[model samples]
Target: MSINAKSADHSPIDEDAEQLARLGYTYEKQFKREMSFWGNVSLGFTYLSPVVGVYTLFASSLGLGGPPMIWSFLIVGVGQFFVALVFGEIVSNYPVAGGIYPWARRLWGRKWGWMTGWVYLIALLTTIAGVAYGAGTFLDALVGAEASTASTIVCAIVMILLATGINLGGTKLLNKVAMLGLIAELSGALVVGIWLLVVARQHDLSVLFNSFGAGGGSNYFIAFAAAALIGIYQYYGFEACGDVAEEVPNPGIRIPKAMRMTIYIGGFAATFVCLSLILAVPDYAAVISGQDTDPVGTVLSGAFGAVGYRVVLGIVLISFVSCVMSLQAAASRLSYSMARDRMLPASKLLAHFQEKRHVPPYSLLLACVVPILVILGSIVSPDALVVIVSFAALGIYLGFQLVVLAALRARLKGWKPSGAFQLGKWGVPVNIAALTWGVLGITNMVWPRTPDSPWFVNYLVLLSAVAVVGVGLIYLFAKKPYTHSDAPAADAVPPSGSNRSVAENAQSHHVENYL
Candidate 1:
């Protein structure tokens, strides 16, 4: 277990360096350890923002599973708690800036780590496109008729640029914005849910168990399966804190705590807000019949009136901007961490951290530019965001499963977690449960929502996911990028901008980690 040290000479970064050595590696400690526990919490929470997620995804869940879709909040939340537990244990042992990549490398091997990072990086990029597109759609709706394809595309690009700019300003500014976002998300979601539920609700609590027969069957099993996406997608972002562990103090302990905290805050918030919106939905017969497709807008407008609905929309917009900001931050860190190992394209440039700004400028640029192009694609095709969001969920779930499966493999090989947060007698059982939940969840996300539709229409999510990873593998073998050796000879390479060998001088007691 990691503990707080009182000696003035003992900084958190020093302990961090020692931990890296124990894992058979060296980190030059270029990034600032400027993130607080709350800042980490804000990043994770806003990344999983219930207000933004519920506001955007509630319609699909309602349209497919009717009121019974509300049950998925609890079911997905419980399943994800097991995933979080597994992640918390891994993070406590192998905390690193890239989260799953470095953890998988330390647990399994280099190829495993690279592939994990590959899928995760794509997931983050697509999620940026998805979140920004959702925000743009909402903004257009709020503008009422001035909204056009051009306007939505423009809105998404502008939001993406804003996030990139905010990230470039360094960790302090990022944390400031994170705190602002947390306040907006928590206050807005809770107030909106309570006010609507208490004052203008239309259905009884029992309505939540009714499916309304969306798929034309005695049981709406298919409808429930499709509706599960809303719940599954909302909860996967709790690991953002772990991705930026290099920037947090005492990450061995703190990152684990942050991961669980994110789940607690996000799970309850998503469930409460989802329930409130569903109960408060007006004109339920029309909504169930597909006449009123916007249950969120309907509920808010009915409860708060038209003008007040716009005010709530504005708050939800804050959550969206914050969500993308945290996503870009996490994604850039993954790229920066992997590139620093000379493991990815343009490794030199992507690995270079701006000493003055204390940020990875090139990696941040990659994160921003790719999402911009994705938004442009959305401009060409009106329904592009739907497919993009599906792919986003599929990519994330697959990436997570790889790490979880790696953990189970390690456990089977008699590996024990040396961290302070070991699961003890429950480790094997928990690992099994985590892997089981992951496979089940991934299958749900990738399975065709419209199984009988045209191949392109029904299987776009599956085909896109397979294409991404399959192409990535082909490129990997064709290029045969050398993953730098696990542990460089201690006497071989010198530290960047230093006279001493990096491995031999790995633990310097004097200088700050700001090399």
Candidate 2:
């Protein structure tokens, strides 16, 4: 566990090990650094899967805000890029396994990290269930099987089991599948988008600006804000890159670059796909007026004929499987990271890693089981499932903003980022912008827009956020899990003016002050 001269070795693998050692943890040889830069990017891109995002939200977005809702991609994309930059800075410095948990722990304190991870962990589980359920609907379509609540739930459980099996194969298999997913998904998106734009265009370019009375009068911004969920949900898959930091060589340098690549590339693909779908819609009035509840299917079926539409459906299914696999992998890693620190109940079991496969078996199983339970719980009321799934995007943003807030707090406390990729003077402004955008985005998402629905349904997002945080706080104080860990805390090192490296500073300070 001690840093030696080898810690100074400049080779990527050695440097990564050295970096982990510097962070007060021994290098875990179980996690071989098998993911290359592109593999890392693929995990993130597939997780972000433009196909999944657009297809899932398209009808609702179009109904709520018309063609102009497409702009949410650009707006949320820009804002998330700022968030990605903030993440890149933190991951460059920490390069730890858990994306937000370890980053928050190092930046703030143990309790802050626990709450952030708790909320994010629930969000990830909810997202897995949501994605799996969506995939089941597509699976039904591709197979020409009748879609029903029972059938979709069965298909979703199958998808979850399949993803779990693949994930248990370890990071190497995860990397290969992620890369393949990236190729299939990206190519499918490009092909479908180009075909729709060139061969099936029903509306002119200016159609994007037309809202078709979507705002219910002169309050278009209200509608636009509601539709922004399309982008908010799509842009977050970038952080999956850092979730497996130990499995990527030169993580401090490579992971940051991979993160930015996910945003830049994923954003463009999502926007292009959204735009093409918008232009290809044969009748915007029908979509806006609720006459066409399934515009995506209508467009694909009309433009591609029966056989070609089925072919596209197959590609979409692949994207969904890839997305589910990537999400499960990330969820397991986060679980493992937290459990390794003895943060969660049954920590020892959850933290157990398979020596030969370099995988956290219990953690992976936990990830798989939780989502299936969630899916099964929804059988009584399918609408209840939708309400729970709706909290996914908001929960993710809250987790992200907590990290951003932690970074800002660390910065104000005179902590300078000393990673391979520091933002230098630009750090503060970028952090501020990211935080501001996150607050606005969260507010927009939680706003009770549906007047006709029950009050609980409209305020579900806010209520869910408060409920999750409230539970976490109650547990935090009642059990005081943070006190059990010997891991380094926020005050382990002096402020930025210190000449010594964080590793050296941490080595000198006693690990104390849990309260």
Candidate 3:
């Protein structure tokens, strides 16, 4: 009954198809498996994009937690690696599209999967919008245009459309662009970090210990917690590797490896870049005391000069576009996976794949259109946009924890992961650790520490999470989308020694209920 079972006579492709059949699904050969392991890593790395993360949040983190805030990357990186391990095991066993959705569906039930996917889908779309919007800010700077909310929104929409067009070209182009993005982003980070450290270093390593009066001398932990967003936001895009599970050959083996590589490589790059920027700042006191509002730009322009700064700015823009492209691809795949299960409105259309291109056209369109709408909505109330964008990281963490919880539930019900990669005796401990880290992370993100800000603004992360789940609950009960699909429900493996396949066991349970 284990999906990992392989026969000497069966080829890997044949075995994969057999596994899919055993899970009550047919293997669609038209869905090309063109991505190699490195390509998968590139997708995730570009999505993680240290350039985007460090550039966007450098000033905020420095202001809030001082130079010491650079350590947040290490802290968050370790926690996310635990998460990556959990995901690797799940995806290796299921090897299903829609990273979290399908894995949750198989581990727990349809309802759990539906809600997980729903929350994750909204979060992913919001993230896409946020990334594109960030890209727009950089693009405006690159073109020497004035920066404004209106201009940013307009530029964001254009970027979204560009990413959508590339995505529509199919997985091959996605892989190639992702690899190019990986090269540009990594090289840019290295060049920038080394240049700053060697030529523009203004602070010694000891400066990392100084708090610079952050947290008002009462609670440095609170300030650190607030600053943790820099790491939390950057670490997650690794899951995008699993989002394209169906497009990678030998995915059971390769995707897990790629996921780990993303965390290891991406974490080091982010940390190095953050450290370099922190050391290169002209004055930490100015940044912390609210004098230097644009510390990131100050350092880059000062270190690289005017023309060199523009070149670096252009590289940052590429990182943003690549990040947007990867986000869009992941979001579209999640949509297609959910729609194929008839779990969403317009399932038939949303699940429609362009046979020639081997891409889900409608799903890709949904991903593009929703983010554009989100960008446009910003024009009405920019504050509302901030609230929604804040939920992106918290919502993604919630979605990840739900899958971890589901996996724990399955293990308690006697399901041992028989994947190409597994933690074995370490599974339960690692799972517990990952879940604990995730809970702490969610709390850190949602905690209202800003006494000066408005009540809603302070509590935006928590409020937005509640609002998303509230709406999803209402829709779930009213529409009963789970009833439309014939996929297995609460399909946790029974006690050991069962000869029946999982699908067979699910069917037998259904028969027994009927009697």
Candidate 4:
């Protein structure tokens, strides 16, 4: 357990650090190692905040595919669960600060790892803008604001600034509010779900499969897939558990459990709220046809009245604020982790942890500033934000699945899966499933289907993604930033055609190298 940190050989942080050292890199003694078990779990849960996830996109999902989108949640949730299992195995064995970068470097190599962190960090920032923007909608509804583009953007800025302040207060403040946010989320889900289910079950249970002819084109599946994006967005953030892997206690055991629990709890909450609101949607046709004022808003107002609905929105607001706080923390940690490896500009400054604050000061600042700027531009052309978020989802999935792919490659070539939690015989199959699911998910998300308009606008997501990567590559090669020596033994190629025991590899390797 990496609790309040101890010696380089004793405490959980030491345990985690020892694992880091064996991976050909030294652990930087910076963070306070102060997050508790619940605090760490809250880290993932809040990042994947079900209230924020479900409520943010609830109306859109209903409009796109009606009630059947719930099935999309189930599919993505299950597929994402398989991915989470792979992550659990990784975190159990590695348990380091820079979640994907270190894991990928160990499984693949430095270049792959750098690309993984680069994509994932930017994705996180894009999502921060999306989530903060989402919060603005609910806040606007609660406050009876005009809900204009300007008002919504301002509301988002307010929430972002508030969350930024809380994040800057450091993890201690983050943890306390995160737990409270979890409570608010759980209670809100329960109260909202049960009340709507009991008092407002207007539709039959079978409506879950009803597309209601909302499918946009000739292909019904196309519309269903489009709506699935909502759930797809909800499920990916659970991997934040691995992102902040080093800060928690008993991370070998705790981190994996926290990861799984995030899916279990977040999944249940998201689906429950989704189901409750769907059944209570009153007139599905009206909602899908834009005749109703949004099924989610309708259900909340019907069940609790306007005042009571605003009360619920208040809880959802907490969930949103808390979600932003957690996302910022996770994003900063990723930045710090990558910067620690000297992969980014101003690596020294970005990687410097504020010892007194127990935070990555510069990383935290960047985390806030970039998103704020993006949000500002989003205010200008909301479509720009949409392209950013669409690609963010794609980028995150690609980064995460790349690690899974690397692990699968290693597993096939004599790398044994060993951790406090091991998949054993199930490892190969699970890894394969994760990769398959990832490819499908990424394809669906990044596919260029904007209907009408020019090729550039239609393929904006894919185009933007390729452009960013292209630019990043140019920057990478131009700067030649990866010049630092990376603990030389790390890249030592094994003897040609030599067959080494998994046990032997595990030993020289950091898996058993730490032990």
User: Largest lDDT belongs to which candidate?
Assistant: 2
Q: What's each prediction's TM-score? A: 0.91, 0.95, 0.94, 0.91
User: What is the C-alpha lDDT profile of model 3 across 1-515, one tens digit per residue?
Assistant: 24444578766666556656666668353467777788899999988989899899989999999988988998999999999998988887777778999989989989999999999999999999898888777777777888898889888988888899989998999999899999999999999999999999998999899987976787898888888789988898888999998888777778888999999889999999999999999887788888998898899889998889899999998888889999899999999999989999999998888988999999999989998988898889887788888889888999999999998888777776766677888788888989999999898888888689889878888999999999999989999999899975566566467644364442221100000
- Clashing residue pairs in all predictions, respectively, total 0, 0, 0, 4
- Which pairs of residues have clashing backbones in candidate 2? none
lDDT of 4 by residue, 120-206 (tens): 888889888888877777877888986777776787778777887887777678778878888888898899899999998898888
lDDT of 1 by residue, 1-515 (tens): 23334467767677776666655656454677888998999999999988887888888788888888878878888888888888888887666678887767666666777788888999899999888877877897677756677887788889999999999999888988998999898998889988988898888899887776665664588888888778988887878889887788778677777888888999889999998988888766677678998878777887888798889988988899999999999899999878887778888999888987889999999989998888888657757766666678788888888888888887765565655466777888988988898899988876766657897887888888887788778767876553454433212123345454332233222211110
Cα misplacement distance, residue 435 of candidate 3 (Å):
0.3
lDDT of candidate model 3 versus the reference: 0.85
Winner by TM-score between candidate 3 and candidate 1? 3
Model 1, residue 440: C-alpha shift (Å): 0.6
Worst 10 residues of 4 by lDDT: 506-515
CA shift at 220, candidate 2, in angstroms? 0.7
lDDT (10s digit) by residue, model 2, range 1-515: 32222344355576567668768779354588999899999999999999999999999999899999989999999899999999998887788898999999988989998999999998999999999988877878888888888888898899889989988998899999999999999999999999999999988978789898887785899998888789988999899999999999877778888999999999999999999999999888898889999999999999999899999999998898899999998899999999988889899999898988999999999889998988997778877787778778899999999999999988877776766677878889999999999999999988999899999988988988888889999989998889889886674235567755464453332211110
lDDT (CA) per prediction: 0.79, 0.87, 0.85, 0.77
Ranking by TM-score: 2, 3, 4, 1
